[model samples]
Target: MPAIAVPAFALAWWLACYLISRDPKRATLRWQAAALVSYALGVAAWTMAPGSDTAEILLCVPALCWAGAVVALLPLTPTERRSVDRGALALGAAFLLMIVFLPQAGRLVVLAPLVGGLTLLWRLRAQVTPRMLPAALTVMTVLCTAALGLLLFTSGGARAAIAALGLDLLVAGYLVAVAHAAETGERLRPDLRRALAAGLAVVVLAGIPAAATMFLVPAHDGVAALQFVVLAAGATPAGLGGQVRRLLDRLALADDGPLRSDRAALFLNADALLRRRQHRRLNTVGETEFLRMTRRALHDFADLNRLARSPLTDLPSVERRLAGREDQPRARARELRAVLRESVSALRPPGPFGTTDDWRYYNVLQFCCVLGINPYARRPKTDGMSREARLAADWFRRYVPEAVTKQWIREGAMIVAERLWSEVATRRQELPAGPDGAHDTQPVNG
Candidate 1:
C-alpha cells in the first residue's frame, strides 16, 4: 500500500508540475511545481528502496534531491543568472556525489543541504521584506532540520517515532514555504484563513484514533503519540504566522508610506492576476456588461505597463529599454488597439460606444478625433465629471493624441482597478480626490 500510494502521489504531483509549466505567466508556480516534482521523486525513491546496505546508501540520492527542491523555494536575486532548476540540479548532483563516495559519512551528507539552505536564507534576509512569512518558513525549516538530524543519529522505537514526525515536519515545512510564497505581502482572504484553521483542527482530531491504536498495541512503537504531537504542533505556526502578521499590520501605529517592498510585492501579484485573467474567457451579458468588462481589460493592460517599470533587475536598463521602444509610438498604438479589440470583441459588445459610465472615456476620445476638434478643447458643459476627471480630460485634449489618449484611458482604468484592489500602494494620500472620485495626480502617460 505504501509503495503504491507513494508512487501515485508522485505521479499526480509531477502531472501538476507539467500542466502548470505550460503557462508562461506562472513563473513562480512553475518553479514551485518543479520543486514539488523533485521532492516527490525523492519520496518515491526512499519508499521503494530495499532493506540492504545499498538501499540505505541509495536513500541519500533522494535526500539530496529533496534538499535541492527546498533550495529552489528561495526567491531569486536581481543579479542571479542561473535558473532555479539548474541551481537545484547542480546542488543535487554535488550532494549525490558526496554521499555516494562517503557512505560512512551519510549523516553529514544529509546535514549539508540544510546548512546550505540556512546560509542562502541568511544571505537573502535583506532582500525579503514584509519579513513575517520568511521568518515563519525559517522556523519551520529549522524544526524539520532538527527532526531529520535526530532521525539520522537515533535508534529503536525513538528512531521510528522521529522518522514519522520528521516526515510530517518536512511536509508541513513545504506547505508553509508554498503558502508564504503565494501570500507573502498580500492580505490572505478570510476563507483561506478559516480553511487553514479547519485543516489544523482535522490534524488534531486525527491524533485521537492514532493514540487509541497505540493504546491497543502496547508493545508497538509509540508512533501514535509522536503523530499527534507533530501534527498539532507543526500546523500551529504555519497557520498562525499570517494571522498574527495581519493583526500587527492593522495595529501598527505609524503610517509609513507603502514601502518599496510593498510596491514590488503588489507588482508581482498584479502581474500574475492580470496574466491569469487575460487567458480567461469573458462571459458577460448585454452591451453594458460587455463595456464594463472591456474597461476592466483596459485597466489591466495599463497596470501591466505601469508595474513593469519596476523590474527585478537593473531598473535603469529596463526604463531605457521601455523608453527606446516608445520611439515607435505608432506601432505601440497599433498594438494597444489590437489588445483592446481582442478584449472588446470577446464580450461581443454592440459596438464600443454605449450609454454608460464605462463608455465615458471611450466616447470622449472617439468624438474628439471624429470631429477633429482642437485637442485642447475642454467641455465645461459635461456636468457629471469631477475636477480630477476634468483635469484628466483637459490633459488628454491638450497634449495626448486621440489614439494615444484612448490607450491611456485604458491604462488609467487599470490604475483605478489597482487602487481599488489595494489603496495603500495606489492612492496618493497627499492629493485630494476630484469630484468623480479620481485622484488629482498626473495621469499615467502610457
Candidate 2:
C-alpha cells in the first residue's frame, strides 16, 4: 500500500470505533465493514490515480457520511458531544499523518472535509459527557501512533506530519482527561472524589513522562510526549466540580436564606420572597439560574434601603455618614445590638466549608451589597487617620445622622462580627457531631 493509504485506513478505523460507541444502537459491525470498504476503494483509486494516488480522499468521504448519520441519530447528551469531537480529532490526526508520509495525497480534498465534519460535530455535541470525551481521545492517540511509524520509515517531505500529529495527539489526550476528572463532582457520589483524584493522578503521572519526552526526545520523538502533557492539563475538569464547591460554601449561609438540594435557584424561595411582600412561610430558591438574578436583587435592596432611611438625609452625605468615623459609629452601634441579638442566639457552629471568620466576611459582603457600596473598594493608602474608614466611614457619613455616624460604623462592624459567628454556628448544625465529623468554622479565602 502507498504511504498515504495507511493513514487513510487508520482515520476510517478510528471514526468507526467512535461512531459505534456514540450511536444509539452500536452499529460496530456495520460501520466497521463500511469503513473497510471505503479504505479499500480509496487505496485502489490512489494506486491508479494517474501517477500518484489521489484516491485517499475517498476514505474520509464515507467516514464523514457515517459520522453525520450518527450525529443525527444520537441524543445530544454531554457524553455523546465529547465522544464526537474526540473521534473526529483522532480521524483528523490519521488524515494528517497520510499527508506527511505520502506527499501527493490530494491534501485539501482529504483534510478539508475532515475538518468541516469535526467542527460541525463539535457544535452539535456541545453538551458532552466527561467520560465520553477522554475515551474518544484515546482512540485518536492510537491512530497517531501508526502515523509515527510511517514517518520513521519514510525519509523526507512527510517527517513533519509524523512529528506534528504525534505531538498534537499526546497533548490533546492528556488535557481532555484532566478536565474530565476535575469537572466530575466528589460529592455526587461517595466514590466520585476518589475517581476524580485517581484520574488526576493518572494525568499527572502521564504528564511527567510526556513532558520529559517533549524536551528530551529529538524533534520527532519528543513531539508525542509534549502533546500528551498539553492535552492532560487542558482536559482537567472545571464545570460541575467547581460549581459543587461553590454551592456547598453558599449552603453554609442557608440561614441568611435557606438551603435545599435543588440547584434550580440560588437562595431559598428568594424569587417568591423577593417579589410580593407576602412573606409567608420561608421558601428556598435552591441553586438555580435564579442565583445570578438574586445577586441583582441584593443590589436593588441596597438602593431601596438607603432611600427609605431618613428621607430628609442627603443621599451622598448620608452614605458618607453611615460609613463614618469608627468611634462615633461604635457608640451608637449599641442601639441595633438588640435587633441582631436574636439572630445571633439562633446561630449554629461553622460547617466544614468555613469558619466564624468566613461567615463574618460573607455578612460584610452582603451588608455592603445591600447598602450600594462596593465592599471591595480600596482605602486611600496615604490618607492618615481621617480617611482610614473609606467603607464604613463613607457609608455612615452619607446615610446615618451626623450624631449617629459613629454608631452606624460600630453597628456595621457588629454586623460583620455576627456574620462570622452565625456562619460557624450553622456549620456545626449541618453535620452530625462526633470525632470523625469535623466542625470547622474556618474562613475560605478564595
Candidate 3:
C-alpha cells in the first residue's frame, strides 16, 4: 500500500495545494483541503504501522475531518464562519464513539456525515439551483444512499467495499463538479479545472491498489480495513465520475456570482484572496469577470497586490501609460488605483449625500466594496469617518440587497472601462505619429 500510495498522495496533495492557493479566502475550499490532507495523513500512518495502535488513533482523525468538511460545503449564504460551523462540531461529537471503536465500520462511520450533509442540503433546498452540479450530486446522492442501504444484507467486510467505492466516486465528481460550477460563475471557489487533470491522474494511481485491497485482503483487523477506506477517499477514484461526465454534460455549483451567498460573507473571503493573489493571468476578461475582478480590487483598496492582478490593467490606456514597463505590476497597480478612485468620485451626486434611490449605487460602492465597511459586524469601525460615510454605511446595511451591490460594482466597472477607453482615444488623437500615420494603427485592447 505504501509503494502505491506514495505517487497517489503526491498528486492529490498537489491538486489540493493548487485549489487552496487559487482561492485562499474560500472557507469551503479550505475545509475540503483539510479533509483531503487529513485523509492522506491517516493513510500514511496506517501504512507505517499496518495494524498498530498508533494507526488506529491516526485513522480516527480523518472521520472527524470529513464530518466537518462535508458540512462546510453546504450551500450557505453570506453567514459568518463560527455561526455556521458550530453544528458540525456538535454533530461530530455525536458520532465520536462509532468513529473510534468501530472504525472498521467504514460505511456506518461515513454515513453519519453523508446523512447530516444531505439533511442540511434539504434544509437549504431553496438555495439549490440546477447550476451547482445537480447531475453529479444527484448521482452521488443515489449511489451513496444505495450503498448504505445494502448494509442490511451485506456483511461487515462488504460494507468496507461499499463505503470505499462510494468515497472513490464522490471525491472525483464533487471536486470536478465544484470546479465546473466555479467556471460557470456558480460558486466563489476559484475554478478547480486548473488542476483537475492532475487530479484524475491521482485517481488512476491509487485505484488499482485500493481495488485489489478491497477484493483480496482480509478485513478482520480494524486498521487493515480502515487503511483501504483512507486510500479510497484520498485518491477519490474517477470511475463513476467518468461515467457522470459522459452521460450528462452537467456539473457545477449554483450561481455564486457576488449575488449568491457571497453577501453573507460580504466578499470577505474574496478580499483576503485578492490581497494574496500576485499571479497575473493575461486572459481576455468579459464584462462579468471584469466586474468581479474590479470589485475585488477595490475591496482590497490599499493592497497593490489586488490592483496588480486587475484585468482592468489590460486596458490600452493602462498599457500605453506603462509603455515598456507593463511587466511592473505595482506600476500598473498605481494607474488602476487612480482609475478606480476617479470612477468612485464620479458616483458622488451633485449635492450632499442622502439615503434615497438616486444614491443607491454610490452608497453600495462607496461603503461596501470600496471603503470596506461592514455595518452588520459586531463593531463597525466607523469612528473617525464623516457623517455622510456613516450614513452611507447605515444605508447600505439597511437598504441594499446583497445582490444589488454586485450590480453596482458592475456599473462602476463599466464607468472605469469607458474612462480608460476614453483616455486611450485622447492619447491616439494627441500622438504625433510618423509621416505615414494616416493608418489608424492604435491598439484596441492591449
Return the top candidate by lDDT: 3
Q: CA lDDT of each candidate? A: 0.41, 0.36, 0.52
Instruction: Please identify model 1 stretches exceeding 4 Å from their true place.
Output: 1-78, 83-88, 155-446
Q: Which scores higher on lDDT, 1 or 3?
A: 3
lDDT of 1: 0.41
By TM-score, how accurate is candidate 3? 0.53
Total clashing pairs for each candidate = 3, 79, 7
Lowest-sum lDDT 10-residue window in model 3: 237-246
Q: Give a tens-digit lDDT track for model 3, residues 1-446.
A: 53444444444454455545544566555655555565455455545455444544443444455446546656554444356688777776666655566535452564566556656756665544334543444455565445444532355533353335336433633554454233323332333442455456655665555545544654444644465555445444331232233233222324444444334233333333333233323232333444445555666677665455455565555666677763555666677777677777787788887877677666766777667777767678988888888887777677776556656665665655455445544544565654766423232331
lDDT ranking, high to low: 3, 1, 2
| Candidate 3, lDDT over the whole model | 0.52
Q: Give the lDDT of residue 349 in candidate 3.
A: 80
TM-score of each: 0.38, 0.22, 0.53
Pairwise lDDT winner, candidates 2 and 3 = 3
Runs in model 3 lying further than 4 Å from the true structure:
8-18, 48-109, 112-303, 310-312, 315-317, 320-324, 382-446
